[model samples]
Target chain A: MDAREDRGQQDISGIYRMYSKEVYQYLYHFIGSREAAEDLTQEVFVRVIKSLHRFEERSSMRTWILHIAKHVAIDEYRKKRLQTIFAGTLLKLLPSTEGLPEKELQDKEERTHFEKALLQLKPKYRNVIVLRGIREYTVKETAEILGCTEAKVKVDFHRAMKMVKEVALHIYEKGAGVNEIS
Target chain B: MKFPSDEEVLQEFRNRPDAVPRSEFLHTLERKLVEVEQQHRSRSKMRRTTIRLGLSAAVLLAVFFLAPIFTRLITHPESIMTTKPEAPLVLKGQQLKLAEVSPAVKQTLEKLFNLVPELKTMEPKVIGKEDGVYEIVFYQKEQGKEQRYVSVEMVAATGKISNYENEKAMNEEAPSPTEEEAKQMSAAFLQALLGDEFKQYQVSQNANNDWSSVAYTRYENGLPVFLDRYYVGVNSKGVTYVNTPEGAQPPVSSEAFPKPGTFLSEEEVIAKVASLIELTYSLEKDTGKPLLTYSLETTGYFHAETGEDVESVSSHTSRYSDVISVKPGGKKLAARDADEVAKVMAEEFGIDMNGVSFEADERILPDKKGVEGTLYKSSGGTEKIMVYTNNKELTGFQIRGKIETASSTQHDNKPANAKLTYEEAKEKAVQFLEPYLDSSVKELKIDESQIMMPTSTAYSFSFFALHDGVVVTDQNYLVNVDGQTGQIVNFMDNFMKPIGPFPDLDTAISREEAVKQFLQSHPVELGYILPVEKETLQLRPLPVYSVDTRAYFLLDAISGKLVK
Candidate 1:
């Protein structure tokens, strides 16, 4: 399609038209932290302007922008960790604020448990699971976004599913313990 | 596509779409990006607009250094545009082959042309070969310089004179000089050195005279011995090189003939050193090439008088990475790779330490170049330190991950007179090591002295203790120290010297004069002058100087100055 389009000249209006809702929704489901997702989504577009030249046209514009967002989030994590260390703290706890609608709190809690489980996976497995199962990007799209071959993505996806099953078992066990206490 | 069993799990998470409030998130990031973008844009704009003007200013400064030299070359008639008819041809095709010429082959032929000064004026004969390199041979002799033909072979890929060999064939070709001829050459040298000291003294070849010739043989005292056949009668304040037959031509560059004393006079050495500093500084300022401050440290190696290789002395500077800058907070930083920094340092500073490596932390800059750092030295169970820079402010250094140094006191062989209060010794050491100090040394501490095993027959060893963070012991001579006086008995530090800052224009003129007299008989001219900016050594806007009359002159400058 319009692969040769000058993404830099397109500006915020073009970004809004093409990616605003999709990126927001992707981030929201991935993090379960509403504030971070919203903040990171905006940051992703800001970076788009700053690193316009690095978009080498090898990947779709959407995939390239998502890659930037991923790196930015990783940098944010590192910055926060360094600050905590400098402040003489042992751990900078992740934000755990629950902001789901009351009606969906149960589903949100399950997702939160899965998110913790996902964190236990290495970054590669976690990214694959999120892209394939959560974001619904196809295996090829996931490979292209990650700069890997489609076959490798499929293998990682299979391993991610197996890890999730293990995570699901742990979640159910924890739920049962809470029920017994109640 | 068939739905996976996990679709329900994914759909549940997607439906809720847990995200922070959109408006607040966008507001914070939008502000930060705008600020960063504005700052970057402004700096880039400034760099583009003002850089050209800065470069022109630098060119004007360089022209100031070159104006006199250029003028001298233009006005000289005998050498004006002297060229053999076939000078400008390229032999790049398959028609070339390689050949080797021996220095012995040329030396045998020197006697035939010794009487004719014009025959010595021929340029090095260039012979191209089938290999990707070319050879040029020339014979150079002046009243006082060494009589040898220097042959250089330059490779094609890097146009560098990869091979340099000297031939001594002149002795074989020309029979040994008759006693009368030797006597005449000796008389000429004696006149240059005699100056106002002794006008009418008789000259004789005396092997016993300390003022005899000193070029070919290494004497028992470690001084070079010139052939003893010619001598100058000296009734003088001090023996000088002018008395020697070859004194008129001294070495072409300082690398060949060194002044005979174990140590240079402080003023003499500093005066020479100051010119080098001026040259490096002006070149950087004019061409915009990276400027470096450099220093050299000498270890006694053997007895200073006996000329032995005893211990190693190293110097360092206060520069770390050229591209890395430590952020004020020390937690975050920006940098380029260490390899890039090393590459530029080698090109700019002439330092190519093997296995050169760096680390960035609160202590080191991560990715920038030209940053300053400290040097560390260790010897005799003690550590010593000095600051260093990559810019060649001084002459020589072997830069590495950390510069290893020892206090002057650690060397057991140092003269006893070198004893100073811990503070006094360090201050003296700094005079030599200061040009090489890296940014790292916050302070210096002197430690205890220990006797070291002697590395040579001339002296016993004593070491001084010192530390910055690393312990280094500097060497001293036990015999040279007066136990009752607690003072160093005999040590010379002329080589460890400091250079002066750039003097006013007239002094610059004198320096130009010295170089001019030095190059008076040589047949090379200033090629096209290119513009450079001082900070980055990057080319800037300006015209290069050159004469339209020569093709090979361009080749020589490219091979010499550019590689240098």
Candidate 2:
């Protein structure tokens, strides 16, 4: 209705071009599956667009974008947790690379023990490792995204790392690949 | 199974593949945003008009009068508005409903509808957007059969049309344009869509696609860039689909591209490697027959600047070997001795024979001296390291794991969670190999250029042996570090321990005579080939004029006669 709004409009594409990659990288390590990460990354940007007008100058755009992404990841984890009743135990028996294409299978093949060990972590630990360990975000930034204090972020991240080693040893002892030890 | 430090685990996480979002994913999101922008604009306009009218009754009256225009829009859309796909894109707390196409997006839609009148009845809607570029989908189900459609993706900012597809024309068995007529129509469509930008590209002669499709290559520096070609598919119903490539390439200034005279021509390059071919015989696989053919061989690339063959990349590092001060013991040892070799292996190489058995196996080809097969566990075990020697002088040794087959994709080659970088893996390889080195052999030099690459896993270090700093070329060791565990899972040495004093390498005949004699038997055959350099992950696309004598060996340095 206003000419000023028409003359110099800010659209979602600009926001997407700037922040989509950062959100995708953050979500990818969190979810462990690229397909799910892609879907959730799109969902994050969609939420960003709908709330673009509501954005305040209080937080850096990067922080605001990732804050939205954290919610999407946690929500996805919750959904997967519910699906775990059927998709959980059965998925462990079958090889994850069973029917993937050669290139995709090769790519999945190289994901370090961290992904396999990360799967063994609870959502709380997974979030900490994904942000602090994989993405290498600062404690303050992690705290900001997680909506927790910096001290809590540091404590949780330390505890989460200990669990990774424990799980890694368990997987190695079980002779199941770190990739498959649920 | 030892897990690495937390830093290593974190590095592995960072190294995870497919970390970036797919370009197609970005494109899809761009479209969604475009639809949203249009909707927001429309909803705001609707709200403004409803408030000005001052009543729900007035809004109903406005809808009744606009009904006729809406009816016409559904048929031919002389005037039309775009909307969101799926459910009404209304949000809670926002209280927004209905959206008008943003001004720029509406202009793009109207332009496309005008360009292709058939698009009006097809319910054209912008389904995607990026940076003001709107991707619109238009279609109407064929009266009875499954729905077939067309899409017009318009770049509103640049007015560049990506593709205009018509599944109705493609799927239906209607009359179609001939290959030549299709080419003309394809060119016409590009000109119509791109306007002045159409002059920048020309029709490609390399049209390998089916008759219905035509290709055009963009020109830079007055020469066609075949790599930047685009294809347009046309049929009787105008254009069906244009294969438009996505993503923007970094802009290269005109000066960065070489002018015509700067690079060697294909003909000039091929001339550099051309030599008289000698008649040879090649076996036919199907008939189990030999067919006579002319052959000459060398591997190289035609340098763009010189118009000459630049030899293909190989292990250029000086081999590691004994210093010149050390002299060979005596005459060469022809007879094989198992006990002495085992003694040398145990002492010099640090191999333990307390629980291992040595069986002499001469079945291995090439090496005149038979191999000393050292099997682990005495009785038997899969973990074994075989040692080879020309008499007391050790030639080479190789390590084999239980399931380390070449084709095996298990933990054999996959980088274990240990997370070893190239430098770290190399350190582990050197540590595993330190115990095996001896006095006669000079220090090992890893072919840094040919380290872990393309393989993704397994740091295969080819440590060439040198004598007085000169690469023996023939004498080298291979140590493959397990990509996963950083463990030295494979080791092989092709260094033949010199049993006798070295011979002077002077040939009986001169270089010219040697070449003449060699050409008399196997003449030179020169042709262009893509000499794939294994040092990098991607193959160089440039084809070089070089000889491929992969199956043929060169003349013997001593006798000056062809070896193969």
Candidate 3:
């Protein structure tokens, strides 16, 4: 232990320990893949590393980190739009098999079914659904995360949940098609 | 461990070790971070960018806006504006008009006005950020500038109201709420607003102002965590404070910040704090032992993680880094007659002293106790200059000019006396002061020296006499050299303040006893403060237990009691 050792700055590890799980979960739902979420979580921390010095204390560490994760989600979404097939292939490579917080969505069937229906949603619908519904952020917070009006977040989340219900009903009618991951 | 850049971090994911089941994600990232840190630390210090000195109108406006007043507004309770709204009717920067708000919001506003009698006379400034979230700001009446009485953000969509701030104590005539009543009332308000989540917060009285002050620090594992603080304002007529800025974390959970519990013991914390201490001279604050002798820079707080001692930012600058690079050249400045001074004053400072005569004033605030000086005053008495010298040679001169600033010398041809660099200005300052350097004074160390304007306008310098390396802080000998002309702009020789009839260090209490008194007087408080990350100059929030630097201002040597 060097007396002048830079442990204070190394508390980035502490920060990562604190916020990484939430960031991973946020990225996981937003991106619709477990492996991609893991990679993007790493990406979020990397961005955190570069921008940590510029982190203003006005906002909490969690809020700032979530803001960064939302940015990563948007960038990933944009790349999925531009780098379509490449991102699509990478997203599909990993199944939602392991390390799922079982307590969040009950049994495996419900979790897979919810995830499956979520994957079917458009970016706009998925954004509102994930932020407002799952994260339980306020309309103002969700609007801030999505960079849109509260009206839009409110309307989108309602419509998105309606669409999810329709999709779930459609899947259950076909005896819950688990093979159709994407 | 240092954090890694994500692009470089991707390869580590590819090379993720399979054997390490306990998660090497942090370890890999830590290694990458340390590698980055090593590379960064090896780099040379960035050059300080020099800005050209220019006294623009914007700078003048800024000075008027930011300059602090002597009588404290909150504490004095006698007063307190973005720009104090003129006449109360002319509200500036009101984004949302009364007509712009919904009918429901109008009803809500009317209800609030009737609920609180103070709201009736106050001017309302409503600013709506979203569809339903409206921030209604109320300003006080015509006696003083428009003081914001309350700023509350209401969420109409979700039957929730957040971000309520009541500055009732700002009103000089506002009633007082005792510390206990304030806590109870504020706690009730917070409980209603946050529902069951308010139970986690521990109430503590903020002892700054005369009025009611309370702060709710979120407790986890029976210890207050960083981030989540629901503060109560000066007075709580309405809800005091419900986290003003939208992004501020609510008193929801302390699952994120677990660093508070890991803080070092008091002895270890004191031990770590010793690292920030350096042998420096400080003018003891009303010390039972006189003679501004040796004092330690024992103001730094301990990093709770371990032994790393981080220096806390104190309001007063340390005299340890004083540079006396410039020696006296004995270039004595001769005393100028009234006409000669008037010409320089008019040309340089834009002051018209056409018919003003220098009147002798025995008792003046400008110079030392017995030094005879002439006061040059214009007809309006707004612009006054005190010249502290006989007709023989110049000792010092103090100027208080009118609103319009000193005219800047900006020439294209580059005159013989162009704006001098910091070093050049120092030399010029020495030339002016060399003649007045009394041989009776002990080592006169330069306490502070800096260029006034970023445009290299003027070089301001202050020298203090030190007794055996310990500086007498109030030895206010000062000199300001004009950066443009390299001429002496302002000079003062007020170092004749009687310091002491020296005391023996042996009679003083032990250093250990002094440290104990310091800790006893100023208890180390647990706080999450943003310390600038030296590796990148970013603010990193660190939770540490440390005494307030303001409170731990001065330590007494003999009585072993810390002085504010």
Candidate 4:
């Protein structure tokens, strides 16, 4: 490694210290847990490092970093999906509810409802909704980060939101909570 | 109702964009790039060297000569080029393991401290990243039966109990035990702390072949006892339980424990009442003149020689309109009505109630007629009760009386008394804090000075000091003990260090200036009207700002209640 590489490394390190927290916050909203967020953030940077040489000054450095972030996030989503499938089957086989029969039944019902709504979202729509709703990303910034136009981001975000709302309304119509027919 | 338009939502998004890194994210990418480059360089170097030296032969020779060296390098980096790997750390002198804990030890812990039932499988968590030392944790229910967790840290490297902490001991009143009960509890706690020794006296065996020990000691009451029990071991590294005796040796310290006292005083009680009243009023803000009713409660009575109404009332309140029938220092009891009074007599006097046995005292203060006192005395103890009259009869005229009027009128017979000044009050509070004050505490700081009162000045003092590896701040309380009659009228101490500090609002020329100054350059926006004034001891108010996507800021000023 030469001084020029070292200099380049310094510049990259400087950028990381500044944005690590913001990026971590984004991952935390989607994943939860400080430890997981840090791991994801590190993975995001690893990918960013791999792709840094390929980065042409086509987009601003911020937009480029976010593009890598979007890919990393998608990868995390895939990994989580596989994990969820495994947990779902294993949980199903477990003695339905652990202890305190009445309370466990109620908790399981609520948890199932929540998981159903979360799973209903399409991957593309889920990405937008999670970024917009959970990670608290702005439509314009999310679009920029996702490499889509702002208007496209908005349309997709609304469509995803509509999907969530529809699921909720259907649950209500079906009477899931109290006073509703099971 | 229509949901937000896509455009409107997008606008909100643009304004408060998600918590994505703006520019600093590139640094992580850069570091990774460097790491990848280093890895590539190393791989190429290995490849070139292998090709030059004939890969197969060189690889075999290197492996034969350097395998131990490589392992040493990885495990003991400092010793790689210097010396052979040292022997594995051997914990000696009273070292014990979970498999070794006796049934006697387990029984003692269970009986004494009511530890969580999952004691057998529990493992200690290592504290520091570098150190392999571990600590054991146990939990018990505290006041209100709230679960409080305690940790007994064992230094694994040394096989020593590093520390023991009763997590909620600082906040809640300690449970009182009889001399014998206290001794038993202490013995059990010590046994749990000293894992292996406590386990050795087990008389019983379990299905898994695990056994318990029973060590006997004379009860603190010096009663003759005959019982043997088994103790259970905590874990692999058992140094955390240092206080346990090796055999049946008893504890040396039989020092009489001081009785616990309530955290609240007269002013604190009033403050608590006021806070509760304010909350009730806020909830029913729309209702005009809503009558707020709550229960007045009391607990902990001091035993009197006469044994009538218990003496030295530990705590009292006027929220309930109960008759004080009897006082016995122990479990809290209240009499709200005639039936309650009858129940109290039936329970306390050991005689069946003949309907209601007592009547409410209706003594209105002569100076302040709105305030009424209801004092009751039995052959055992005397109980004092005060009631506030909300009706406009106290100040003689209908002058839309303030809450202060009610307080002033209530204690007319309790004359004005001189006590500690602000400085003196702080001194006294610190003096009272001798046992709990951490060694690092430099001095007490008067966080709050003057408090307005209708009859006397109420003051607040906050004491702070950094001690015992952490900062210590607690409400140091003091009040005027009436010189003539020694009745505590007012008290205050809501002092802890402010969370951080609010930036100087004046230094900034514009709204952006204030936000940037305090929040370190995060986005800013106009926050909603906050009702609570920032306390002097509080850190800066939450920076209500737009980060381009989220409309969020801290809600509570004291702890920085971010809306997230």
Candidate 5:
């Protein structure tokens, strides 16, 4: 490879090393599937490699990469609708929060319920929660990634938190007896 | 049950197991990147070689065939050097997968299949041309002894199930769920789609039978957010359909909108609304009867600070008008006259007005009193422009079609000295609009002006139109000037001609008395209130009010009574 191409590859490798885990976690929480998240992470890197030269530095590199990751996840979602159908079923088959102490199990269950609730939320809401709440990015940073105003990011983050709280509370109180459509 | 704090929620999320990629993921990615780089380099090399060979061949051919070609170019320069037309800026619908359309839709289908495991055997097919909606159909299949067929129409825009149909027959002995049961079922379904906060949406059943529908509206801080609502339908089989607004979500913040202080008493608010009311008339469709309608001339959301409504940032120009072409009645202009105007539109704006029908209507212009204009509507019903017959002046026009090309000569040529200061652009805009500024044009103020920097820089100026001293809530004009030449690139004037015998301002009811009358009827209900911001692609949160009924109505200034 040419020296310039070799330098470009090195830059891409450095970016992947710094961001792959963060991007994967964000996509995982969003799509509720590790397999899909991993696949989309690769796609995100591929896109980053392709568009890296054209990136005008309008936002920070982290925010720009996250933005690309978001698009990749959304595009993958559109391409694999049926695979998403199996995500919940696979999640349900996971081993119960047993063998642990009562309090630990309860906490685990609540966390699991919150994750499910996160999946239930609209994509926009989920985006704010993942970036601002879970990742603990600043509202400005989240806005840059989401391509929205900081005020909007703050508002959505607040609302998403309320929703997560409500969902977790409802699930904890009701248990698994909540109606499942037949 | 108490809700978890934001900290606790975040901690819970953080506690969840991290999704680490497989160990070989990076190795695989590195290999893929190498492959991509090789492919890109080879393509670039091939392109360069092809260009070099093509240039050499062209140079040799030009030497041999130069005389005739040069002569032809000199004879008809326009034919060989015509500019390519710019493609129209159209918002093409995106192809979407079901999951991408809405997470709730995917979850609902998964839940349905899980509940009826046999249905899983029949593959579901989702079809859609739009980005935010899709149709998923599952064909009837014989599973041992039973057959089932189901179809769901999902709208991802609103994250609501628009429709669901079960084509199989079930035993009549198994009755449908009661209205209460249906409400519970619908709530569960919404919770699955919208999360726990959606529980605030109280379901009110409209009908209780084999086919039943329940409307859901969210209540925050005791007051209802009436802006968005969801309708869920239940049949004997199960929950059949749900209709929701696009990007509908419950209020995010409970902080009282227009923070609770002494707001204008009901009496004062009523008076403000009454003073703003406009007396208008609308013709009955069937009888052509002119019915007097009192319109609340308020703009935007009701703000507590000023006790007066704020202006909406989004442009909604075509809604308010005293005279609309109802039946295409007036003196019909000659076809040639229509064609003459249509030719200007075709040549200048790239509007294909050929073979299109035309109608003339008498418009009551504030300046001209009564003027007749010809209206040409495109076949798609998207583009409509009206030109006066007497003066041949363009009056009203609405183009919903995509802008296909830079239709103006000023935009075609780039002038080296075309850089104009903001002051110069404003001066040019004023000069262009000076003819339309009459005594009736009150408070001619610039609403907004911005310099758009891109391929061709231009300054867009939006001017608000006011009547008398009050803001003419619906009337405004927008003009765009070329940054370099100071030439007008685009212009739109949406000022409605009021049919007057205008009412005297001094004769209006007192603000205090009007507010008193308004309070007596519309009691205050507490809810959240969100101020409207300028148009953006992001989803905006709605405002909520505490101890605010959130009801707004216009009152007739003369009578101090609510306008129906």
Candidate 6:
């Protein structure tokens, strides 16, 4: 009810309005599961509200928020990996993509292959690809988000792209029947 | 079948169908945010209330006891006259009660009460004499919600209040003062307490604390002494707590201070600093890939009389290596292969290398690049190093431990005699590094050298690993030679292998421009000028600038971007 508290509430609401959608989309592509991404998105905003005062102006507000989102998604991935091992039988009870219509099955399979290849890449490589290639962040912006030198970002992006190309080619060779869109 | 291009693969990945969340997700998230904020505010309020209640109980207990004392003093005014004693009290042998405080201490307490009359109702208690200083504690309740205990230290020698501490429950809802405001408040409070002596102290704002506390150091003439300093802490509730350490006395005279004109010229100092600059590399935090950087750090101060810079502590020799002596376990053995080196190292350092594998054929030391020695590296490239000559003779041994992540370590610089001359130290250093020298090296140039007089006298000599004629910027060998014994105390050869082709230095910016850029980025700040040695008295007052070496960077010659 105090003026300061009221101002803090306003700030949090403003930040949510500006960044909630972008953060949610970033987490969605990162985690590859809509439900998990939504949960992690909520967690990221909670952290953002708590740590907003500590934000430095060295990086843009969007870069800072996405940095927080990246950490939240990574932590969730680690937790889910542990859960998948412990409750493998319970996970099997969840709905399968195989039950979809034949037309939707091909599209689902291709999408699943792309997600699998991304998940298989190392976290460092995946981070560069997601930030620079998928999200289309500039080299300088990617460097700020990754907390590295710009030269290092460029080098990593080059290597990450090469790896992605090799992985996609191998997947196509495996008879997935996917068209060469390029 | 031809593989898809990188661009094609990237486009396919980027164009993948988006995974949209449910429509109600945002509304749910907003509701959750409000709930979380409310819970946080409630917990914070509860914590403040609990502290307030505890403080109020302590103050009430003090008031209950002090009420009777106040009434007794009012009834018999003669009691106050009788309690005052003129004679100086010596507390060397007799057991003194809390009530029987020294007259000097009582005078100090009275003076403080005169300045802040509201504290008189608290009935201050003399705790005891500690380190020739009397401690007094005063308790009081405020607004039925907050209680405060103000403790003051009265020095026996000077009768000056040396320290003050106020313990109270702070109001969490109160707005914290800005850094600039806290600094101004601290300076004003110090001036009010010390009077004319405040002119001798320089206020330095602390960088780390959220409370924005400020520290004041006493400068004699112009030179700030390391001994006398005061710290001021201002809480969110606007309560100021001042702490002045004992042994702080005003300077006797400013006539004998040395003028800045007699010191080294600015150009000479810059040249000396530039000569000490060295290029180094650090691994990127995310990728663990090495990135080039430059460093010019010194743990030294400029000498007052001689005008020469004196290193307080000896420079560390190793770059990525930490050396530890490994015992032979009473067996004299020759280190022929990697296994022999590993065996000797493990036994000496008492390290378990049971499952650890090492390369026996590859004669490369991890710390020293291009140094052909029998090398043994652990799995993570962090642990284990042993050096031997080409003939497989064990010359030097080292154990690389965990990487030091801490920025800097504070080392107390105790003075020592520099027995050996610069020529003698250089000779010892070169002789120590002679085994690692290759035939390609045309000259062993002593690029930088310093004689450090810490607890132990040692000379640090940096030799550029030159090939043909030009200096190999990345390859430099450092050696520390003991002053007394003429022995090599430490050695580090940082010649990274697979050196890339030398870049064209023609397009590089001029040295003058580089200096201009560096000065523009890092403005000089006035720092405390302390004596080079603790035993040396009457240090000349000279204005000195402290450059934060961590913030210093070398601009790329061509791009003008930070190299490190």
For every model shown, what is its TM-score relative to the native structure?
A: 0.26, 0.33, 0.45, 0.25, 0.38, 0.39
Cα lDDT tens digits, model 3, B1-564, are 122232212222211111111233434554575465454433311211111123244345545653442112211221010112112221223366655765545655665555466787666877565444666777776586776677666654332355555556444455566444565677666665555455556665442222254677655544454434656553435344455332233212233334455668777766654444433334322332344222445434556776555543321234343534334333334445555555545653455566544533222222222343444322224444655553334456655342212211232112234568766876777665664665545456674422221122455667765555555565546777656766565677654434555555566665555556555545566765434344231234466665444322344565554332
Residue B249 local lDDT, model 4? 24
Model 6 TM-score is 0.39
Against the native chain B, each candidate's TM-score is: 0.18, 0.38, 0.55, 0.17, 0.46, 0.45
Between candidates 2 and 3, the one scoring higher on DockQ is: 2
lDDT of each: 0.35, 0.51, 0.50, 0.35, 0.52, 0.53
Taking the tens digit of each residue's C-alpha lDDT, what string does model 5 give over A1-182?
44434445445655766687778888876777766777778788778866665443335678899999988776765676523353375456344544545544454466567766676566788789888877667676787798654556877888877876676567677763232211
Give per-residue CA lDDT, model 2, range B323-343, as digits (tens).
322222222222246566556
lDDT of 5 by residue, B308-360 (tens): 44333321211332211111112222323555666655654456675543433
Worst 10 residues of 4 chain B by lDDT: B394-403
Q: What docking tier does model 1 reach?
A: incorrect
Query: Which candidate gets the maximum TM-score versus the true structure?
Result: 3
Evaluate residue A154 in candidate 4 and report its C-alpha lDDT on the 0 to 100 scale. Answer: 71
lDDT (10s digit) by residue, model 1, range A1-182: 12112112323334443565556665554444555666777777767765654333335667877777666655654555321221121112222335534433443355545555554455567667777766667665676566554556778888787776566557556742111100
* Candidate 2 lDDT tens digits, A1-182: 34323321333554666677778888877766666777888788767765654443224567788999988887877776522332343244223555445543443333334456677677678788888877767775786687554556778999999888777666556745433222
Worst 10 residues of 3 chain B by lDDT: B77-86
After superposition, which runs of candidate 6 have C-alpha atoms over 4 Å from their true positions?
A1-182, B1-174, B178-188, B199-211, B214-231, B239-396, B399-433, B438-494, B504-508, B524-539, B543-550
Provide fnat values for all models in the order shown: 0.20, 0.39, 0.02, 0.07, 0.27, 0.24
* Candidate 4 runs further than 4 Å off: A19-41, A56-62, A75-112, A168-182, B1-37, B40-564
The TM-score that candidate 3 achieves is 0.45
Off by over 4 Å in 1: A1-13, A77-112, A174-182, B1-4, B19-24, B27-36, B50-564
User: Candidate 3 — what's its lDDT?
Assistant: 0.50
Ranking by TM-score: 3, 6, 5, 2, 1, 4
